[model samples]
Every structure is written in structure tokens, then in C-alpha cells.
Target chain A: MKVIREKPAVIQRPHNFCAGCSHGVFYRLIQECVEELGYSKRQIIAMGVGCNCNLTLSKIDTVDKFQCAHGRAAASATGIKRMRPDLLVMTYQGDGDCGVIGLGETLNAAYRNEKITVFTVNNLNFGMTGGQMSWTTLEGQKTATSVRGRDCAATGYPIHLPEIIAGQFRPAYAARCAVYDPKTVAQAKKYIRRALEAQINGEGYAIVELLGICPTNWGMSPVQAIEHLQKKALQEYPLGEFAGGEQAELAFLRQEAEK
Target chain B: MQMAKKIMMKGNVAAAEAAIRGGAEFFAGYPITPSTETLETLSFRMPEEGRVFIQAENEIASINMVLGAAACGARAFTTSSGPGMALKQEGFSYAARMELPYVVMNVQRWGVGLGMLDSGQVDYLRDTRAGGNGDYRHIVYAPDSVQELVDDLYEAFDVSQKYRMGVLILSEGYLGQMMEAVELPPFKEIRRPDWGLDGTGEVGLKQLCPTYNMALAHELLPVRQERINRVCREMQRWESVETEDADYVLVAFGLPARVCVDAVRRLREEGCKVGLIRPKLVFPFPYDAFHRVNPNVRGFISVETNDLGQMVQDVALAAKRELPQRNVPVYCYTHSAGVPRVQDVVRYYRSVLDGAVKEVY
Candidate 1:
């Protein structure tokens, strides 16, 4: 018999994430990409607050990881990468950790074009904290605090961080991908690999926003949550690379001027 | 005897150069009053020495950067003042809990919330105790002058890693800005600790804290207590002047201590038995020096530059602990924001001698 599929050495045991949650899937995808791209031994992850820290309990067998303070993973990764440029530094954060409280740190890291990778799990709400309304929570979505449903007029619209980062700042790579289905999961894997390669090539900062479905938080079955993420969340956060191309931003500027 | 080369420079620049001499490879900080020179000097000096230096967007980012560097076992630090240091308490607490070694030079400003830029000792209580949340203690060094500032900061890295804890250089605005002739320490090459996360997964998995650390907290309590006790036992340092057979002793640190030295001399010349005890290490409180003071000492005067006198309470505690048999009176004299005037400190001592002022403790 031939070996068709096997778990990477980076992931030594089953993760402790909720059943049917996309966090474990994205975790496996990242480990697989790290194993595939040959950075299995030389990558450091600055893990942020929120469910991202839950990965610490997953018994990651190898690869260095620092559970950074809330909202400061990008800044911490800056120090790790700056002190030792030989190592690949990355940040794993949640929507609340990266797009809300850490907006300043995340944006400043990109503004400086620090040579690091950022992977944010956008599950629409703050999952680990009993499903509070997060920066990425869509309008009309009900959360713990927004029990009446998120009112855009009052709470404002969902923040598109990757879009904001890619549209304004100059990163080496910036893309958003969903993991609700097999094809989308494969697409997420490619974006994850591209973000990793961007750092390995020393091109500069790279970011990939992974859209995850929190079935427990969304109060839906695994199947229903997947459909909701695809049907509703996808509209607010489109999947594509927001940053890339030779002088596309300049072209965008000139085209805006003409319009 | 060989003479070390001496140069005249400001305290902030001296701290920056001394950090480099102390084997500090990374520095992250935001520009704030008095302490800004340290950040400014290192901006160019770090890259010139092939080291890392970043002017982060804010103090939160700066201290977290220091945390990351220290997590990698690299000697790193950040410089800030009162408000900025308050901003850094979270990162400081994280570094303390992680048992990571780093240093912070807090050139203190007086008051709260966008405090004045003048020199003061308002942070004396906060820096010696836990500045952030939780029950943890880090080493605090108080220097009286520019030369002492250079010396303390030079040895900060060694002392921090020796105990695997953070170190705070409790500097004052006057001391950080004043120019003085000082001999900088020699540039020493030290090896980074091997237990840090090198990011080479070739080694065993190094979880840089919290989950496993939280689990280990119960087991780590006694270890932390013993470590702190050991630090307190071995790291007590201070200057004792005419403390033998004196009737009263003047206790102070940093810039205020400089004036206390003068007050002590003037009092001694006037047929008075006033002595001086200047603590070099504020956290340990120099209880050992208090122990060796005149047994017949009538009172202890604490000179400070902050409102309501912060260090006076510590002075009272040390006095009460060292001489438990009798109730000793502790008087406080605060110059508020600026440096204490020599005459004011002397007059305050006179008032204490005359029993015109009430004892605070």
C-alpha cells in the first residue's frame, strides 16, 4: 500500500478547537504549508490573544511559538524578526485581536513594511470570549453584546482589514480566503503558502486573512455555519489578493484621478 | 594603577552607550521627555554597531518588541517616562511572568497623566513594587548621578539574566539630562542564553509561555519566592556616610540623595551627628545599611522630589524593621517636581531637629 496522506510532524496531536470549527483546519493547513515549503524547523509564530492562543494547548511538537500579549503580536514579531533576520517570523491572530484592538500595531507593522507574515482568523465574532461583536461582525449579525443584531448606523460596518492593508499599505502579499469547503480550503492553503514564501524570499510583509466558520458561536450546525459563511460573510469580505502586481497602486491612483 | 578613559556627556547618551557596552543588542522605545535622548542616541548607534533599534509607534509596541527580543534570549530594553512607563506595565508584567530578562530605563517625570517633564521620584513606589498587575517583583536600581547612572545601567543586563528577571533603572529627569564627566564601561561580549526560542525547530519545542506557564504557575510560586528572596539577600547595595554614632540619618536616592549628601556634611560641621544613607538598589530597600546605622539614632529623614513623599514610607518601613525595639520617627521633605534645593533640605532637617514638624511615621 502507498502512503496517500499523512499528518505533518509539526502537528503532533489532535487540536483542542471546537468540533467542526475551521480553526483546526487552518492549523493543519499552516503546518502542511510549513512542512511543504521546508520552513518546518525555522519559523517563529507570535500567537495573539483570543482563540489563537488555544493552539498552545494543541501540543505543537516543534517550531517556536510565543503567546504574545493581546493586540501586540505584530509588534512582537517585529522584534523577533529584527533581532534575528534569519528566522521566519509570523503572527497568528483573531479578528478582534488583529482588526480591532491591534489595528494600530497591525497597520504600523505594515506601514514600516516589516519582513513578517500575519495570518488572521476572521470568524466574524470574538469566538473565545463568548461570541462578542467583533470588528468583522457583519451588519444584522447578533452577538452576545449585540443581541439586537449589529446595527450599521450605530456600530458601523464590518472592517475589511486585509483590504485596508492592501489598498493603503504596500505589502509583499495580501489576500483573503475562506475555509468553509474543500475547494476554499485548498485556496486558503495556497494563500498561506504564498504568505510564507513572501517572507522566505525576504520581499517584506505578507498577510492572509482566513475566513473561518465558528459553528458554536454562530449558533448553527457545522453544515449551517458553512452555508452562512459562504452565502453572507463572503459578500462582506470577498476572496482575492488585495495587494500585488507591478505598479498597480500607481495605476489605481492615476485611474482614480481620471475618474 | 591604570586610568579608564573618561568623557563628558549627558546621562541619556551615557545610558545608551552603556547599554551597548553591556551587550544589549536590541532597543525599542518611543520618544518621551528626558528619556527621549536614550532612544535618539540608540537610533543611530545601534545600526552603527550592527544591532537592532526601532522607534515603535507607541510605548505598548516598544515594550512588546522588547519582550519579543528578550524571548529570543537577546539582551533588549526600552526607555520611557511616567506615562510611557505606565503604558509598558502590561508588557513588563508579561516579561516578568515569562521569566524573560530585559531592562527598562524610566527617566521619571512628576505627577500623573501627562505629568511634568521636571525630575521627580513619584514612581519610586511603583517601580520598587510591582508596577503592573499581579504579585511579582523586579530589581530596581536608583542612581544619584550621571556616573552612577552609567554604572547601574552597564551592569543591568548581567544582573537581569543572572536571576532571569526584568531590571528597572529608576532614573530621574535631572540625572538623565545633566552632563558629567564619566568613564563608560568596556564593551563586553556575552553569550545569549540557550533556553530561548531560536526559531530553529531543530531543537525541542519551546512554548514561549502562558498556556503551559499558567499550568506551571502553582509549581512556580515557591521557585519565584525563593528567587526573589535570594535577590533580596544578595543584591542590597547603598552608601553609608558617618552613620556610626550619629543621632540622625538622612535617607534618600537619585537626585534628592545628591542634596542629602550636602545636607549631611553641613550638619556634621555644625557639631551635629546627622549621617546619610543613600540606597543604590531601591527594591531591596538596603535594609542591610539600615541595620548598620547608629543604634542611638534619634530620627530618619527622607528627602524626595514628589508630592506627599513616596520613599518616606519605605524609609519608615526599613527603620521600623531594622530597629523594632523603639518607635523611630521618620520625617519627609519633598521638593515636588524640580530638584530639591540644598537649603530647603537643610532647613527641613533643622525643623526635624527642632521638633517643629510632625513625624509622618
Candidate 2:
């Protein structure tokens, strides 16, 4: 017998995203999770502005997808979750979409502990909008709008969303992952899986912020961008779990179920 | 079968009861004059009925919460007056863009600022045409009587859900505060759509919320235009009284519309040919229906209670386009900063009919 292999569910066509953009890798990881968890058929992927908006055109099997107004994907996701709680719901948003325009809805959802997962790709700049500085834009990063390196004194510091959400809402599972290298990509997969698992267990809100690399926007080659992310960005945004006592809670529930 | 009971109730209370009878499961709002009773009534009744009722941090939060709940497949609603309505505009626009079905009751008071908590239909301009951003249209109902208010509430929810759009119930301070007889309807269980975000277990579906998408915007213009066209085609309704033989048409809505009816009767008694055309759905503004009336009408007297003549402009535009050569003069009688009485509208109608009044744009 011959075995036929295929690309991961996350990989799709009309790939207009610039080369070395982490969006493709993140998409693959998310698709893989849905396939592994048996949620593929019951999942609805909400794709928001920036690079993630391309997900709407992607042909991901068993996952219905739609696009919403900029910065409002979280609120739409909230509506979707309320309307169809049985489906595995997730939103693919960028830093500008999640951290800026959608800040209110995002924070409110976390506070309310809505049962949904938000996969936020924080590349420090609004990559899709001609590399403008975003809420998560690194202090010294240069972009189209910020011709001079980002001024922390004048523009305020980068918003550490995971830390803010963890401090305030304490969601079921919250973590920051990176996609700078193969190892971090694997680590990001774990965090994404954990967040989805939390939703499956009816634990609460889960958010995974991936510190991705936007090579084109950053004015660096793909390899150099990865190295830059590892050397510069990683220091400011350390990877780790920020909230959710879900691991302990899940264990307790399992014990009780066994009993 | 249970017989419906008729009782006099304030417009706001009737609006609240209508929401409950319409199977509204979640309500979030902040207290504002003339509209506070809606939140108060829901706060007590919702919990008792196993519905979710919350007093949100502010008008913005309240609308957002309702949007959240409505997205989750609950029949959701909120109520407010002028200033609060202004604050809720952003959320309202998002709700429309996302295509969430819910009810918003604006118990109107004078505005542009901190206009007194008096009965006024000035919000007609803001709420009717484009209270929110985008080219999307909202299903609007202006109720004069408490019964009409209740009836409109039920219809508003049905229209909202069927069309996947926001519905506005435009009432005024007088309607919100005045007591009137209303017949109560039996409660029915609301069957939520499979798409709402109640929780993970109930519907076995993912909660979808609205997000901004620039890529979609590239192709959004045509798609949005089509939606607006469909809305215009399907959702326009109007009510007219003594329009046949009358030479003058009085255009109004909500309490002002009710006053126009009295003005029409008085004008007829004074041997002037006058009639009234009341718009039930303000957004898909009933232009075609208004055009069907006799063009022999001399002019239209727009009675509004706002300083800025908003709805009057819509009426004038409609009249000019529809009945261009009826010698139709558009007269604006604005009770700026106050509600116009029936006698005041009758006086305006008489002047317009007798050709004694100089048209004020």
C-alpha cells in the first residue's frame, strides 16, 4: 500500500504575504491544532485586519471563515461564540487589530472569560498598512510613519498585552510565544494547543500572542529578521504563560471525573 | 387560548414588556431620564425569567455588552436618551457592520448637547438617517401610543433577526413618561440561532465577533452597497390618515406624528384640506409610499421638535423628487428646544393651506 501525504491544514493558496512572514507558519500551526483536536469540522475562523485578513481567502477544510471590520473582530468573535458555542471559535488578529482598535472588546472579553481563543500575531508594526508603528511597535524600531526610530518618551512604551490581560482578567490560559526559529515555532504550537484545549474543556478565555517576524516591514532579510527578533524583540517580550490556573484545575476535574 | 389584557402603561414600560414578550434574554443599559424605566424593569424581570440583565459601566459598555450577548444568540436590547445614545454610536455602528440583530430604544430628549429631559423628536435626524457610520441602514420604528410602542418592539425584534440588522424604536419623553392603555401579549420562548455565543457547551459552535479587515475593504464597497439596496427594497413602511382629498400633507413621526393627526382634524374643521403621513420605519424611509399619494397636494408641513431641521429635509427631498410639480411647498415649523403642541401644528397647517405662510427652509 502506498501512503499519500499532504501539507498541513494551515497552509493555503493565494499566498500574497511577503516572503518570511510568520503569518504562514502561524496559520499552519493553528490548522494543525484544529485537525488534531477533531475540531476542524466545527470550527469557525474569524480573520481580522493585517496579514491575518488573508486567512479569509484561504481554503482551510472543515473550518468556516469570515472577515469583519478592522479592530472589531473580537466583538464579532464574541457574537459568534454567543450564537454558536458548540463550534471551535478562534480569531486570527494582528497587533494593531487586537492591541489598538480592538483593545476595549479584547479586554472586556478577557474580563468576562468568554470561551474563545484569540491567536494574536504581534510583529511590532502594522505590517499590512505600510509598516506603520503599532501599539506593540518596539521602542527603537523604524517604520514608514516613524521615520526616526520609535521614540519611547514621546510615543509611550510598547503595550505588553499578555501581561496586561493576565494582570487584569486572569483568563483560563494566556501566554506569549514566538516564531523566530524552529524551536520557538514548536513552543508556539504547544501554547496554541493549550489555549484550544482550555476552550474544549470549557475552562474560559484563552489568548496566544505570537511574537512574529515581519521581514519586509522591518527592512531586514528573512534570516536577519529572525535573528533580530531573537536578539532584540525576544528580550522585551519574553515567552511564557501569563495566567490561567487551568493546569491545576484540569487535573482536579480529571481526578473528580475518575472518582 | 389566553385573552390579551389591556392596561394603560407608560411608553417605556410598554417597551420593556414588549422586549420580554419578544423573548429578549439579555439586556444591558445605563440609566438616563425617560428611558431609565426600561433598564429598571429589565433589571428586575430578567433575573426572574432566567435572563441576563446587567448595568454596564457606561452607555458605551452597555451597548458593547448587549452586542456581546446578541452575538451569543440571545435576544438582546438596550435603552437610552440623547447623550447616552451619542456615546453608544460607535458600538451601534459596529453592531450593524457585524450584522447582529438586537433592539435599541431611544427615548428621545432635546440634544446636540445637554438638552433638557423634555419630550422632543429632534433625534429623528441623528437616529433615522445615519446614527452610526458606514452605508448600512437600521430598521427604525416611531411609536406614538403605548400599544403602538409595544407592537413596534415585537416587530422590531422580528425585523432585526430576519434581516440581521439593528432596529431602533424612536419614542419621545412624553411617550416614555405618559401613561396609556396597552394590551399585553402572552410570552413565548425564544429559539436562539445556532450561531450565538452562549457558551461552548450549549451550541457546540465558535463565537464569532466583528473585526476590521482591510483586505475585505478592497471588495467591500460593492458588497456593502448591495446590502444597503436590499434593505431599502425590503424594509419601508408608512401610515397615512385623510390623505385622499387633502391638499396639504403633514409629515411627522413618533409623538409628533400623533400630534399631526390632531392637527389634520383641526385643519379640516377650519375648511382646509390637510392630511398626515407617518413613517413607521424611519431608515428605509418610505419615499415610494409617500409618492403614491395624490400629487395634487399643495405642500408638506414638516413638524419636528428639534432646533436643526433634520427629518424635514428628508421630507422635503422626498417631496421634491416624488411630487415635483404639485406646487408642493415644504414648510418647516420647528418647536426649537421644545415639543410642538397639536394646536401649534394646526396653526402651521392652516397657514400653509391658506398660502398665508412664507415657506421657511
Candidate 3:
């Protein structure tokens, strides 16, 4: 079979993410989206300090990248987008980076309707620092910080960033998707593409939260991690476009459902 | 005699106009007391001049906005006072270490932790001596007048770009809120070189900042630090008035320096041989200026607004560097309770002259 889509040449190295890690999946999707949309040259990605930070080490020669202070990616991206509105600006962050440490910056970016794209990956735990309890870790999930399983009473519940952001009217697009299965991966890419489109169209503030998998951190096999995502992560974070559809698109969908 | 137009305005407004005149195209700031006029003026005027101005959600976001804009090679700036400056320290340090050139105007309000809206010297160490974490120093300037504020800020952008580091204009409430006539400089076009990330990324232009990889830092930091040290050494600036044949020299900066100058002139009229050494650039604490003091000078008095006499420590260090064995006496006449009084400074000089006050250091 002739290969219709090859690996993006921009990502030349063997990815440094761990086995069953969803960061690779998201990074590949971002590369493909940028490549297909022909924004590879006019794009700048602000990388947050997290498990996905290794993405900068890959040496993507075409696209510009900035290493942001931990949890300051949205604020930094705000600067980049405001200064160079001609260029497409985006920030890639993890749950702890956005939801916990940088929640204020993320929300304010939405409030200001900054014309930028933000991709937040929720892998249920902080996978880079040997799997600590992240802001998106489930109520009962076990990790390095919560060895005896998380207690919602003390640790609080996992934050659903997509839902929180979608509730805000300023964002041109906001969505939550996953990378557990091929079908879900396609949904993730669609949402990611739409988020980028919002930025391209000059619609302000686009965010997409991707439910990622971390097999090593979760202490499970790669297959088990996928199953765990499907069973638990999806149950909490249903895959759908929470925002960004035009009124006409919604009207058409409603009419089709009536038929 | 230069044909420059003079305008009557508040010092903070003068600073705002000076920033625009200095080719600063981007500004992001949080409105705080004593510094709000700068932001307020820039909000409307910046967009009118086709520049970017943002009333950031907070000081942290404001500095980050500057960091981002500076990364694009645009001349960016921000203004804040005490608490707000504290919030901006993280981004300031990041910019310093990344070698990103930008300007910061700190219209200092009197406070440690929200103390007062009046002018007090609380951030002497915080502004000049490594305000942020880590082992890095940036250029710091304290102007004594509205004209000096305008002139120094015009050069501050150049110094910042030349050094590729953040430069701070430490304006206190006394200067920021005071009304004075300032001659603003003419506009100059700024040039952005073929570097930075101003959307030429396809040709492979990149700006790296805030490193965490210790291995890469270990190899690169020492060289970068050596370059910074050399620049700091070259940029030492101070104003020494009448120390040629004096027995006592008063060390001060900013508002205190203005007061000390008045006190020194009054004491000279009273047949006392006193002088003033006012530091313009506080960080590259002019150690060589102390060497210029006459051998007959008996003591160096630091008249400051901070109660702890933070600048006195630098004065001692600089004095010791010049007179290691001679024991040049360093004394402090601080006024943390309020602004420094010329009478108090004059009184302290007389006490030193009369051998009534002993030099502790």
C-alpha cells in the first residue's frame, strides 16, 4: 500500500517520550496539522516545563519554539501573539503546568480573548518527575505523591480544563479529546485542527485539552493504560467539541437530527 | 543650547513619553500607586503611535508580556512600584539570564509590604543588588530629576540593547509624582537585526531563554557571566561633586542625593569642606569613585531613606576597596520613618566634622 501520510520530517528524532505516553501522539498530531495547514514556517510553539518538554530537543528546524517558565506558557504566548499577530502562536502544556501552577494565566488568556492556541495534555499524573499527583490526577489515582491512592477530601478532584474553558464565552474554540484509540486520536486531531483554525481566522482564545496516557507512571502495561483511559478517563472527559462551532453548523446538525 | 522642546508634566508622564521617544514599542503593566500615570499615559498614546500597550492582568503577566515581546526583538517596557516590582522579579530574572534586552521603570512607593503611598527608599537592594533569584545582575539607574529621568531612560534602551539584558530605571514616588519641566528627546528609529523571532522562523531564527538543563548551562554560563561582568565594569557611572579637597563626602542616590546636594552646598557656605558622591548607576557601584576622594577626607556618610541603610554596605565595600588599611569611616544617617531632611544630613556632617559622631565601620 502506498503511504498517503508519512511521518512529519520536522520531527526528525526518535521521540523521547516513554512507552505508552500520549505526548508523542499529541506532538505528532501538532506536526501534521502545522505541515498540512502550511503554517510550519509562520508558527511559534511555546513549550511549557513538563513531560512534553523534550519536544523542543527534537530540533524542529522549520517552526519556531520558545521554552517558557514553568506554568507561564500562556502568559508568554500572550506576548508572542500580541507582538506578532501575523504569526500563528501556540502553547503546549501539561495538566500541572496549566491547571495547577498556571491556572490564572490560562483563565486570563481566555478572558482577554488573546488570539492564540493552547493545547493542554492531561495524563492523570506528572509523568516527568517520576509520576507525582498532578492537578488532573483522578480522585482515587495512585502516583508518586499519592502512593496510597488520592483522597479527594485532601487532594481535591481532577480539574476538567476543557469544560472550564468552554464555559467561558471569550474563547473562540474549546474542546476535550483523548488519544487512547485510533478513533479518539482522530477526534483529538480534529479538535486540534479546529483550535488552530480559530487562531488562523483571528478568532480569539482557542484551547483543547487532550486526555493522555502514561503507562509507566500508571504502573500498567501499554494495553492496560489504553483500557484504563477508555474506562476511566473517557468517563470523566467525554470526547466532543465543547465550543468553536458556528451557529450555522449547530443549526445544520440539529436539522439533520430531526430527520 | 540644543533646540529641544520642553514640556511641563509629572515625572511619571515624562518617563512614559521618554519610553516612547526611546523606541520602546511594547508596554505591559499593572496600575499601582506612583506608577499608574505612566501606564495611563501609555495606554492611549501607545496605540495612537502604532505601538502595543496592555493593561496586564497582573504584574507577573505584564513582565511575561514584555519577555514575549522582547523575544520578538521589539523594544518592550513595563512600570511598577514596590509590591508589583516584587511580582515581576521572576520574569525580570528570566529576561536577565536569557540576555533579552528590555527596559523597566520602577516608580518606587514607600513600602516593604504595602506600607505607604509616599516616597520611601525600600527597594535599594531589591532594585540594584540581584532583585531576583540566581546569581545575575542587571544595570540599574536612579535619576534625581524629571530631566534626568527623561535623559537616562533615553539612554537606558540603548544600554539594555547593547548589553542584551534588562535595564531598570528606579524612579521613586518623590520623582514619579512630582511635576517638573522635562525636555523630551527626539524620536529615533530602532533597528531590529536579522535575529529574534519576529516571524522569520522559516529562515531558522531562534531566541532561547530561561534554561533549566544544567548540563548545557554548565558549559555556557561561565562564558556568558564573564561577558556580563566585563560590561558591568565598563558601565560604572556616578556623579562626584567637590570631593577634590574635602574632609567628608556624603553618599546618596535618587531623592536622597538631591537632598544631600543641597546640604553639601549649605555646609560649604558655612565654611565646611564637604562633598557629595551621587550614584547614577547603583548596581555597578562605582568602587573607583571612592579612590578619587582626597586623602584628607575623614568619613563617608550614606544618607538614605531606608532604615537599615542598605546602600551603606556598598559604600563601606567601595571605601574599603580604596582605603584598605587607612580605615575610611562609613556612617549612616537613614530616614526610614520619612523622607530625608537636608537639616538632618547637614547636622550629621557637622557631627562628623566635630568628632561628635563616631564612625562605626
| C-alpha RMSD for every candidate | 3.1, 4.9, 2.5
lDDT of 1 by residue, A125-186 (tens): 99998999998999999999899999989988899988888889889889998887788988
- Per-residue lDDT tens digits of candidate 2, residues A76-194? 56656655668788888999988998787688778888788998999999988789999798888888878899998998899988889888876888899987677888888888999
lDDT of 2 by residue, B258-360 (tens): 7788888877888878888888877878888667777687777778888767787888778877886654778888876556788888777666657787775
**Arrange candidates by DockQ, highest first: which order?**
1, 3, 2
lDDT of 3 by residue, B65-137 (tens): 8988888888989999999999999988888656788899988877679868888777888887777788767
Question: DockQ of candidate 2?
Answer: 0.16
Off by over 4 Å in 3: A58-62, A246-248, A252-259, B199-213, B216-222, B354-356
Worst ten-residue run, lDDT, model 1 chain B?
Answer: B203-212
Tell me the whole-model lDDT of each prediction, alpha carbons only: 0.88, 0.78, 0.84
* Model 2 chain B lowest lDDT segment of ten: B199-208
Can you tell me which runs of candidate 1 are displaced by over 4 Å?
A: A245-259, B202-219
Best-performing candidate as measured by DockQ = 1
Query: What is the model-wide C-alpha lDDT for candidate 1?
Result: 0.88
| Candidate 2 vs 3: which has more TM-score | 3
Task: Answer with 1 or 2, whichever has the higher lDDT.
Answer: 1
Chain B alone, TM-score, model 2: 0.91
- lDDT per residue, candidate 1, B1-361, as tens digits? 5788899999999999999999999999999997999999999999999999999999999999998888888999899999999999999888876888899999998888999888889998889888888877879999988899899988999999888889999999988999999998789996777678777755422334433267788886786678889999999999999999889898889888888888888888888898989999998789889899889899998888888888888899999899999798999887899887778988898898788998999
